[model samples]
Target chain A: MTADALPPRTVRSAPDRLLAVLAAFDHAHPALCLTDISRRAGLTLTTTHRLVGALTEWGALERDADGLYHVGLRLWEIAALAPRGLALRQVALPYLEDLYEATHENVQLAVRDGGEVVYVEWLSGRSAVGVHIRVGARWPLHATGVGLALLAHSGQPFQEAYCAGPLTAFTPYTIADPARLRRELAEVRRSGVAVSSRQITEDTLSVAAPVHGRDGGVTAAVSIVVPHATAQAAVLVPAVRLAARGISRALGWRPEAR
Target chain B: MTADALPPRTVRSAPDRLLAVLAAFDHAHPALCLTDISRRAGLTLTTTHRLVGALTEWGALERDADGLYHVGLRLWEIAALAPRGLALRQVALPYLEDLYEATHENVQLAVRDGGEVVYVEWLSGRSAVGVHIRVGARWPLHATGVGLALLAHSGQPFQEAYCAGPLTAFTPYTIADPARLRRELAEVRRSGVAVSSRQITEDTLSVAAPVHGRDGGVTAAVSIVVPHATAQAAVLVPAVRLAARGISRALGWRPEAR
Candidate 1:
């Protein structure tokens, strides 16, 4: 389904209705008029109007002069406090910057969200290879370097379930076989790095390493994406690992504790 | 009032109660237990539980293994679409990075929110001056360089009202007098830059320039904060202004259109 596709309209409770109004918005539909919201949220126009008014007053949404509703600054302020979102990105930024400076390539920090990897931070130079990833973008857990590192370090049951099947391929090189995927994950665990070549895009490659949290759990993964033809996994691995370790240390990860 | 202070409880509507539960979390109280949220939101334990359950189910809030609630990744994804928040920061980040590279100081992008300036992005080197500013941090519009730039370019009515108010001074150098504040704003407009010295902190200074949107209105401001003892406004002004202009251009601002 498309990113903007709404789930079957089963919303019933007052809170659910209100949240459905919010759920109407996505990356593809950031701004919407009252009528559009009503349709997308599967709500009556009257209910949509009332809920929209409440949200606008509470600053969860903002209505522009043109009568389109957009997500507001207040919501952004609150979201910045998310431990796995901006907070993690803020802690990892300096290391990400150092990696960017060293590689002049596209750098990313991501965490696993169930079956997908959600990018929390991304930094790229003006001249870096074109990358489709952006903050908040998501990819399946087997199609990118950060995804592989996260999957390899994830709980066994989850890793097994993920390796079961339904792997979507973005390029010919994307690992579609369950056994091969499991083997690749094992390799990632052994080497402490994941090198994904021409997986998401044929011309792009990435090297990634996992970042640990204060409790020594793999909390996130950091990666650098470079052009496939000129990519040097050997050189990129150590830098990416160092950046990830720096972020892990900043997050209070102690290697000695393990 | 402190950042964590709650307003007198008058919230009655269903939407208001739900939003109140969200407002309970802030920079100072990012993680809260159910009891804490109940008190902060001025809701009964029963109501707080119901609202928290709804919010958690909707992914607006996440309850950790320890049962502490935090703003969730899904909410962050939705807030990423805020035109004045992450969206604006995304467009301006490359320019901010360039400014950081050139100055090796604390670089910031902020937008005016009522009488305050909300920092949307901040970048600093490991060795950059110790700055208290962080992403999502807010300050009075007359105190810091980005704030001053934003306030100077704000609408006349808003500017006049803000200038007439009780300006809280952080340091002796902060612009507290209405007349002097007005004069400083005038100079910011006349010089196309704002220089705020030892306003927020005694050891820091900043130079800032207003960033224009497509409509030729100042939508945000960019600034670089450095140690006050070595700050040279003459040297920093051009770089800050150029970064602001670069961001403005990226936002589709056209100088010829004006």
Candidate 2:
């Protein structure tokens, strides 16, 4: 096919087209060439070239010696201002570190993003059991302990809407059924913790608790992952809860507010 | 003072206008209203509105309940791919944590950006001296231990340019004289460490070492900040150097390669 043979399609807005170029780079594809971006963004080569040039000039994208483009430090600096991401993580890191120190397990902090939980901070101990969680990773609200803690505390309408869904199960123990999920959530609310055993992985278990903000609303969740075979959920619950409460207080969540 | 009283300036490209909206937010001004964004971005209200709408839809800028816009999680997720930001911090954190444990002081990992050192990670100990450094904060090249380590190893052209003149001094101990800065850089290179004594603050001292990449080039620097009154630079040098070497090895740098 010749370049001039095809006719032009409807044009996308400048912002949409430019954002598409950035969206083309994700965890699985953190680096891409001009052609790859053009193809992935579904934009013509000329458009992609112009947009990439603009983004590169503005320091949103950096082109390496290999001619592959990666996200730039300038963008990272700006993204550090994200309240729900680095900003929140910065506030919660010390408590998370304490949790790791207390348990020597994989400690994580996450927040609800619609019906999913987005991990904002993850600290993995050297000998901790693998749970496949990383910062910026997301999972369904019913699949992980942090997810459950956040889901249980999310306001009634959002919780109900999420519970009504076709819950995707990762393991046999995942809370796929609506009634069972409701029961679990209620238990989490009552006990101030969520324990998910072999839900995401058969060999791993998680204990999580909700972190509240100044307004007395659950703003995030903190969790620790351990080996399911040797897991002591009861032992981990207090440490997890303590970390969550420490973070909550750090966020200005006073006991009287609750 | 009336509508349409001032004629419009020359038009900016759509991508530039959209980028301006994102650039409007920073550490000092992390949140903004539509009017604030419009004024700061130097775009007309209607243009800012449209660009912001596009960004909001694309999850670049999130509008909170108070009608203030903040950097969104989506941007943070994308920025996580930056090689010098979270990606590098993720690799260096365990070693940095070990340094914190060993010294019971503030441990930091920083990368040179232009002539400044941008801290990529900071683990603050409970009793650590307060040096006013945070993740994503930048400091002049001659004013910090990490900065000195990075600058000393940055090669001839950059070091010469940085040491030439106009070194901003944070304290009386800061290296402001060009000849003295050159001598310090030479000593840093020879000693494989940089001890910045109360350069940034009167009561804080930092000991730092350069971290090398697989290709034998210095990529970052790791440091420990302690109270000058109790700081034993001789005791700290080995710990900081060990942490930096640990991170360098983790990053695939080998002594044989160097």
Candidate 3:
């Protein structure tokens, strides 16, 4: 197909088309050429060139020496102002670090978004586990500790919708039954803890607890992952709860007697 | 003021209009309504409404309860992959925390951008002096300890260009004079440290050193801020230097020394 041969076309709005260009880049595809972006965003070359120029001029995208584009520093600066992203991470980091120091295990802070737990902060430790969760990664509510903790406290309607998922199991031991997942969430609410064993990975176990915001609403969840074979779920449960409560208090969550 | 009475708008390209809408938000005005966005982006209400709706649908923007819009979690998730943003901070944080513990002072990480130093991370210690610096805050190159450290190592052309700046002075102690600032940067290059005293604020002092990347280029700077009245700059210098070096080593910078 020749570039000048095609008739002008339009369907999606201009803003949607421009944003689609940005959405094309991900962790694996962090950098892209002009052609790569056009193909990935499913836009014509002319459209992509115009959109890329605008984004580059506004500092939304940066083009490097190899003619590849990256997420620019200006975007990062603005994103730093996001209340639920960097702001929350900043407030929760010290407590997360303390947990890491105490356990020398993989520490994570995550928030639920549309039935999935999006990891915001990950502190890699010397202790190696096979879970392999990274910042910006997501997992379904029934397959991870933070996921279960967040899902358990997400109110009745949200829980009901999430439990209807045809869950993908990473290992044979993952909780796949809708009825059993319902019972497990109830247990999480009553016990104030979620212990996920061999769900995401065969050799890793995670303990998580809910964190609350100033308005006494469950805002986030914190967890620690350890080797499943030698894990002491009982011993780690108290420490995980203590860390979550400390973070919740810092966020101005005042708990009454349960 | 009816919509039909308005004249047909002058046509900007599709990408320009869309990008202008996103560029409307900044640190000073993080949230806005539809009218505000239209006014700020210089677009018609029709165009603004369409673009805002598209962006909201794509998750680049989020509307709050009262209809004010904010930078959304999705954009922040993408920005988290910026190499100079969260990615760099993630690697430097543990060492910065150790420095904060040892000094009990305000610890910071910054990188040079367009003749200014933009802070990427800030750890406000409990006992630190009250110097108001927020993450993503930018300041003149000669006015901050981290700035001087970065400026000193930023190659000869950049250093010379920055030295010709019309420096903004926050306090009487600020190094606003071009000649004196050049001399200070030179000394920073020689001593491998930068001491900024009572510059940004009369009650605060900062000690800093440069961090190098794997390729031996100055990539970031780390610093500690203390009370100026009772400060020991000499004592803090070594600690700051050690922290910077530790972070550099972690980033795979190998300083060849016998």
Candidate 4:
């Protein structure tokens, strides 16, 4: 949905209005001017100016020489402390690197946020399949390997609710039927790996495995994406699972716990 | 300073109070209960609870299963748009990885924030020097090689204000004297590299070079730390400078632009 469709801010609270300004920035609109922020946030020009001034003063946003506003370094510092974000990526990077070296493919670490999988980290290989993925990018839980891995391990209630959904499809192979999605998730849990082929795109296949946190719950997923034409699921599955287990161990997960 | 040292929140604005709650989380304290957050933010329990609730609903703060609050994934997604944060690191990572493969040392990418250098990326080598560096960690601008490189190129006014300061010394080898620091900065600017030995610790030395942005300004620095006893400046300097230049070019910096 476009930002212009957001509801007006007259009835929102002070904190809500303030957050609306920040929420106006997203992957598609990373930089904005005051009027753009006002229209996107559904705030008046005066309110946007005041809130933007406050945010700039507090280092939550920065204005460039060209007068365009971007997210600031201070906000990044705070966000770096998110356990599911940079902190998790920092712990999982070495293993991800090893996985990349082993397969020379695109490696990703992602966590489930609501019904979608947010990619927290991605390491690109020079000759890997051309996938449209970046750090902080999100995709539906039924369409990608990492997403399937996470959704399968997400608890029964959430899984049931997710299956009863308007499953969006990016390609012809995407699982649009809830019954098929449910079966795929069950297979993922049974095999301890998820292989998604040509779901998001026609030329790529991904192998993913769930990563456990200290509490022994699946907190994240690790995956490797390669060209589907020459894909070797047998080799890629084991490598991806090993990387996930290595990351889980690093996160204080013990095999005996489960 | 401890959280108790912050002044009361009565005089602050609404945005300031909300931001204080976010600012309460840092490297040392990434998670907190409501009471801890209230104390750190210097707000009353009621105000803190209200603000925290609003933030949690907005997905800027998340409450864990154990009831501790953490900076959330949604916040990280927004913060990823910071030009000097993950955006810069994204463009620089391949070059940084090449440098790590070449040196097999502690590689770092840092940007100057005020008078300190904030490390945005770090790649650790298994047997490399055990330096106290982490992503999002900060160090003064006069005691490390990356800091020196950034400080040298920060223009004369900022350099003068930074040098005429109470330089905190971590080791005896640190440049605490203003005149010596000026000379060191001049050398960094002249040679296009900065070499710092035993400044942060007794066993580690670093070589760094400045990275320029599309606007032709030095916006960041890249460095590699190694064991001081076996350090080879002639070899490391060229490698570090090449990595920095490569990252600069990726950021749209051209040699002919200047």
Quote each prediction's TM-score.
0.97, 0.95, 0.90, 0.96
Residues B1-258 of candidate 2 have per-residue lDDT tens digits of 333123334677878888888888888889999988887887789988999999998899999989999999999999998988999988897788778767778889999989899988888755567669788889998999999999998879878988897998888888899999999999999999999998988998999999998888999999998889988999999999999999999999989754
lDDT of 1 by residue, B159-237 (tens): 9999997999999999999999999999999999999999999999999999999989999999999999988889998
Per-residue alpha-carbon lDDT of candidate 2 for residues A1-258, written as tens digits (9 for 90 to 100): 334223334588888888888898888889999988887787889988999999999989999879999998889989999999999988898788777777778999999888899999998755677668788999998999999999999889998988998999888888899999999999999999999989888999999999999889899999988899999899998899899999999999998745
User: If both were scored by lDDT, which would come out higher, candidate 2 or candidate 4?
Assistant: 4
Kindly indicate the candidate among 1 and 3 with the higher TM-score. Answer: 1
Q: What pairs collide in candidate 2?
A: none
Tens-digit lDDT track for model 1 on A125-241?
788999998988999999999999999999999999999989999999999999999999999999999999999999999999999999999999999999999998999998999
Model 3 sits at a Cα RMSD from the real structure of 4.3
In order, the TM-score of chain B in each prediction is: 0.95, 0.94, 0.92, 0.96
* Predicted model 2 interface RMSD: 1.1
Question: In model 2, what is the error at residue A86, expressed in angstroms?
Answer: 0.8
Task: List the candidate 3 regions with Cα displacement exceeding 4 Å.
Answer: A1-10, A125-131, A256-258, B1-11, B125-129
Error of 2 at B89 (Å): 0.9
Write the residue-wise lDDT of candidate 4 on A177-200 in tens digits.
999999999999999999999999
* True lDDT of residue B64, candidate 1: 93
Looking only at chain B, model 3 earns a TM-score of: 0.92
Q: Output the worst ten-in-a-row residue range by lDDT, candidate 3 chain B.
A: B1-10
